[model samples]
Target: MKTYLPQIERRILVRPNQTYGILNYDLDNAYPQRMLELVAGSPTAKDCWNKRTKFIAGNGLEEKDLGKQIINAKGLTIAKLLKALATDKALFTGFGIHINYNADFRITSVSYVKFEDIRMGDTDNAETADKFALYSDWGRKTWKNIMRSKVTFLDKYNPEPEVISEQVCKAGGWEHYKGQLFYFNPEVDDYPLIEADSVWEDFETEAGIKIFNNREVTTGFLPSTMLFMQSRREEAENTRPDADTYTGINIPTQLEKDLGAFQGAKSAQKIIVIEYEDESSKPEFKAYPIQNNDKLFETTERSVEARIIKGFSVPKELINAEKSSGLSNGSEKKQAILEFNDNTAADRLELSETLAEIFSRFYKDINPGKNWNIIPVTAIAADDNPGIKAGNAINELLQSTLPRESKIAALVYAYGFKQAEAEAMCL
Candidate 1:
């Protein structure tokens, strides 16, 4: 037996290099980069990633101005920062924020950093990383030279104001002190695995299947066909005696060019005109009756898609609206949204808390007491009236003993009426 496919081996060996004083993310130091490419190549993975990012970000902060405040000179607001963090978190399960401080050690500006661009500095302790290395191209494919100016060293985020103040004072100014980095990794002592890491091989498999189909189509779907052509007497005689007389290389070369012309969709229904002087020199196409595996390919692709979506914890109802219909469609999607919201609540809370902590130090107006909540997906009225008609639900609400405000709330949420319309009907 022989194997044509590569064996799957997923491991994160955080090898430390004493020479560079930086730890390698996997053996090649390009795990995140490779993961990024995988996500880009797989449609299901990319869709789930976008859905996760959107769900985690939700409707932005409850306090609108707090999110509107520009965090950097480039006009990157807190909302954009939250979205970027959510994007990275959805993909890498970790995110980084570059914080710049003034001479007085007060946070001046903050910017979102690509998680793939960051590498942990070599540390004796396994639990904590004191420094980080930020380079645009960790794979070194974009910038081969990797100049000293391209690399930046940043201190890990220290919450203690007094410690940062003292360090800045010792350095003589903020100019002397490099910026700080707030790296968020839910897992301790190791680089966090991507959300879809468990089904990562499925991503590759899906991509390979697509490539196979593409090649089949491009080559005129001739994978099962073998062409056998007899050599002409004159052509055989023309061959030099010095050359291998048994093998007619020039005959195969011309046949290859003829075969190449029969490739692509344009060749479909095209007539093949082969001229031969006798039956002995006729061309024969022997097609081995290979099993048609289109159904198998489709099933495998669907399984791969489902696994990828499951790995991201996204509901099929939310991703595939076409599969749902009738009265249950809206309700099913609504329930999925609610369930997914609950599943992603922790992610939302993590972003909220991280932002709250950082902003509390940067802005006096923003504090932990102020709610830093990312608004969840609200259920629409259509979703609320599952088996019941909208008119019946509204009539029942109108006849209830509930107060005007309560009735209005029911009309808005349960019957899918706009706030103003619900209020008017209640009045």
Candidate 2:
């Protein structure tokens, strides 16, 4: 229904260039096959697959997932989106579904009904378990109409022409950050190879099975075929001239000027995450995408580590640091002694360590007890493209819940400030 699932759980098998937009010129006509199964729930595997089959793993029936042109026409049929154009890209661009047969199969059609997700039959009420996903008008019946209607096909001379290839996607390793892992290396050299997205490993025993970041869990993989290869390269880039070098790789005017300058912030996003206090450091800190564009460091040794967030103007060393960066119109701190009577002991101890590092940088991932973090220009990115800005601790708690907005726009990210101190820390 609303199944694009890739906030970091990825397992996709796509094959579509066009074939259901219904073709019946007789390759023998009637050659249809739709069998699908994809189950993924987070916030810790939907509490371990619903505390162990109390239920979850495809049954409620809301399995739509063929994005990049996200438009599901209900119970799918335009001939199943044009015989799924045999996984279109001229023929096929990706395929990989191995979580041991992947579980619970039976997909004869519903052209991805919205990336699959539904448990218990007759959709089990409460508005068919939160309705799931439908796109727009083209839906009104609900409860997936108890699955089973009518669809059959096989042609190219009664069943023969089937050849799909071009899949070997791998999402392996890196992104430990703290213990310092960091893989995916789109060739940023020095033997780093991140560009990741396929490293999910979650197991279960069954009995009221509870799974989600558990005794055995590893995350960050969301490549469901980059939303249908960016919707068939944006429908062959409208009419290519090179379609701006192929959709300019999914526009991001620098992430919409870094989330519109941290969502029109007045003041509160901060930076200065420079690390490496000893052991002959080297990766002082370098993250390139742009901004001068030729300095992406890493040369450490003493147990090495690296991170450098951006979006300056709130660096009183890092205010209270983390109150989960949430709390508004809110006020409740000056606890006594006449609120320190306009205090004056060396500028009131630097504004009370900038209000306790602004409550410890928005509550450090909501009250984590560790003393190490380095999110820097935060973004978990997985092919939707256009990200990499103002996630440094929720862009500093959304610029402390904007009460004085009006900075229209101003982001200086040369990979976390530096272009002349990010233009002297913007305004």
Candidate 3:
């Protein structure tokens, strides 16, 4: 009898925007306008993310433009463009780039496109997955009047909806073509945009918390309410009436007039009041003052601060901010700092790789086989006592029975010592 083997079922997961010739409704429904609004309105989000970008894009990368003199247009340079990219990425959680080159093999210009204006195109093929088209609200402004106008004032008040521009790129070509739709495909090595979906919510939340804190701080954190007291309406009718006193005016009406006058005055005055007493044996009065409740939200504020720090992936101690948990000892604090530096180094490497690939592609298109190098500089973070660490490593190598010459060479190279100096130290 012949035996049959069972085959395992498999599935390949792709980005939400990627579908095999099928429209991705989820990505289409992502309400980017609101997301952009949320991020744009957040100061904390801008600060945290921008700081990271600034740290990674320090001084920009060194590049060989192949004598194209591309940066001359509008006094633009690689560093300025990189800074713009960093800022766009921080604010929009994505970066969009437009490369302009001439037919004579020269990279004429590189522009950092706004993320809000980009729409992802065909993703069925890896070659075309990174393709996109840009939409804009330019030339949509209209004149309107408040009353009896052909265009309604409300239409003017409302933001003009973005419409796709004519400019677009197709797959496997450097030529840009016009299109009515908001999508296009490009056969590029990698996507023209780098996006982070997971961190977007964190950025929005951090921004919202910061806005709330700012508002609270400005308003003097308090609970405000309205208080109304029904005063006795009966007037004190003296059996012996006097012309000196006036009882015709209502207490509430007089109070309102006094308040309006006091508020309208140019000079500041303190301790003003409209005193009123009822003729009834028992009088009633009530006051509602804004009660401060800052202490109640202190914990929430701290928690939000911690979350914002974590979202930015920064070391709190670096900014002189203290965390409520862990990191108790000196070693722990040191480790925290080291970890932050490591993360920064990793970011630098990743950014450099991406920038190098992009520049290489652009440069190669203009001048085939030309040199374009993008190097990211990162600071070295070693142990608190490098001498001790080196000594321990050297001792370990010695006990492992490594060659004397190899050990001496290692000492000289690792510790940045001269050959003679290392030899004398080893001796």
Candidate 4:
């Protein structure tokens, strides 16, 4: 019995907020993609959901827009991870047995899923077993419900003879998962690197191997603590022409109906780009009235600009999407760049510095609401780079819902973070 075990490279980011914050992403220096980045036998889209330690991207909005966001974000990233497991479905999805590492060691892997507009995230941006328990419960309650025709069934009651272990064998107890390495914890408990597969191919091979290469990925939430897993499959099994069908810029269908006052030139019109500079942090954006005339926008609003997200306080006009009626023209002087130094990550991330400022501000704004007194998404939408878009996607991906006066403004933040992170890593 010759079993081939392909290694997976996992990439973990520190995501206190919704954005996939890269702590120390060292992909360029990692192992050769072919040497330690491919998984031989992986699960298919259908079977992947039945497992315990699986990832799922539910339609998770602010629990407020809970209704429609569900229709959009369902199965975004986790679904893709399953299909790219390995070439040999037999090897990839094989259940011959299992591997068990403890609590300190999670079964993590890396993929280009987050690189592009690779959205699709777990329900809670914060990871916990509870968020994923539904998948396990659904499978256990009615296995017959989700089983497909192409599924391989080895036996009846002995259907899962492929392995000695049952589903999730926890830290304390063990049932059918006896002879096998159920779980062993060095610090707390043990976790298995089950159906998950990790891989890395340069900017070259990523597109052809992905599931929905046609869609422009704007917003996504990913587990921040993932480990980088890498691997490469043979050309035959992994070969596929690069897909050019993806809509480069995704405009929600609903926004099409609501472009009322903001409709500029195209259905996706030009946005009012306003950039404010800060000595302490990255530049932030502000939205001006969409200039109907091109020649006018240059003189009136100036060229495009971006924001400094690390600042203390965002201008209220930006946060509320209030009309920038104050600045009638470039000459009409108003403090467009608001200063937020005494209170925020704008200064530093030290516990004493950050926390003291945070609590002090909490006391200051201890009124009702999360405080829309924050900066507007447009105030940060002043991206100068040809690539960044700053609206819902960036806010969603970055987890900052800065209000937008228009649909294009909304899409700016949604798409900006991807472009920003992409640029950051490419450098």
Instruction: Say which prediction, candidate 1 or candidate 3, comes out ahead on TM-score.
Output: 1
Model 2 lDDT per residue over 164-251, tens place: 0101011121121101001111222111111011111221111113232131122221111211111111132245567767865644
In model 3, the runs with Cα more than 4 Å from the true position are: 1-36, 40-43, 62-72, 89-94, 122-131, 137-225, 230-269, 275-292, 319-338, 344-347, 361-427
* TM-score to true structure, per model: 0.78, 0.14, 0.50, 0.15
Q: Is candidate 2 or candidate 3 better by lDDT?
A: 3
- Name the runs in model 1 displaced over 4 angstroms: 1-10, 125-129, 143-149, 165-172, 231-255, 325-327, 363-369, 383-427
lDDT of candidate 4 over 163-220, digit per residue (tens): 2133324322333321221111111221112122232221113222232222212112
Worst 10 residues of 3 by lDDT: 151-160
| lDDT tens readout by residue for model 1, 1-427 | 9879987765677899554567889998888999888888898899999999989999888875777878888999888999999999988989999987775556778899999998888886443247888988887778765565777877789967786886577567767986789999987857888998998899898889889888888877766778787654433233567567555455344545566787787786666677777877888888888777888898899899899999999999777754332235266777888999999899999999998788877844554457798998775555455445644556777889999999888766765666767787777
Candidates 1 and 4 compared: the better one by TM-score is 1
Sort by TM-score, best first: what order?
Answer: 1, 3, 4, 2
Model 3 per-residue lDDT tens digits across residues 1-427: 9999998532111244332222221333224454555556655444566566765565455545543334435665666666665565443444555554444333345555555455454456554343453444211223222111221100001111121121222322335422222111122322222223335565566566667677655544433434355553544434345434755533345545554454422423534564556544333344466534355455555566556566667666644322211213345545655665556564555445545555553434543554333344343443436434655665676566667688678766665555665576555
- For model 1, give the RMSD to the true fold: 11.9
* True-structure RMSD, every candidate: 11.9, 29.9, 17.4, 28.3
Clashing pairs in 1: 381-416
Q: State how far residue 200 of model 4 sits from its true place (Å).
A: 48
lDDT of 2 at 149: 32
In TM-score terms, which candidate is top? 1
- Candidate 4, residue 299: Cα displacement in angstroms equals 37
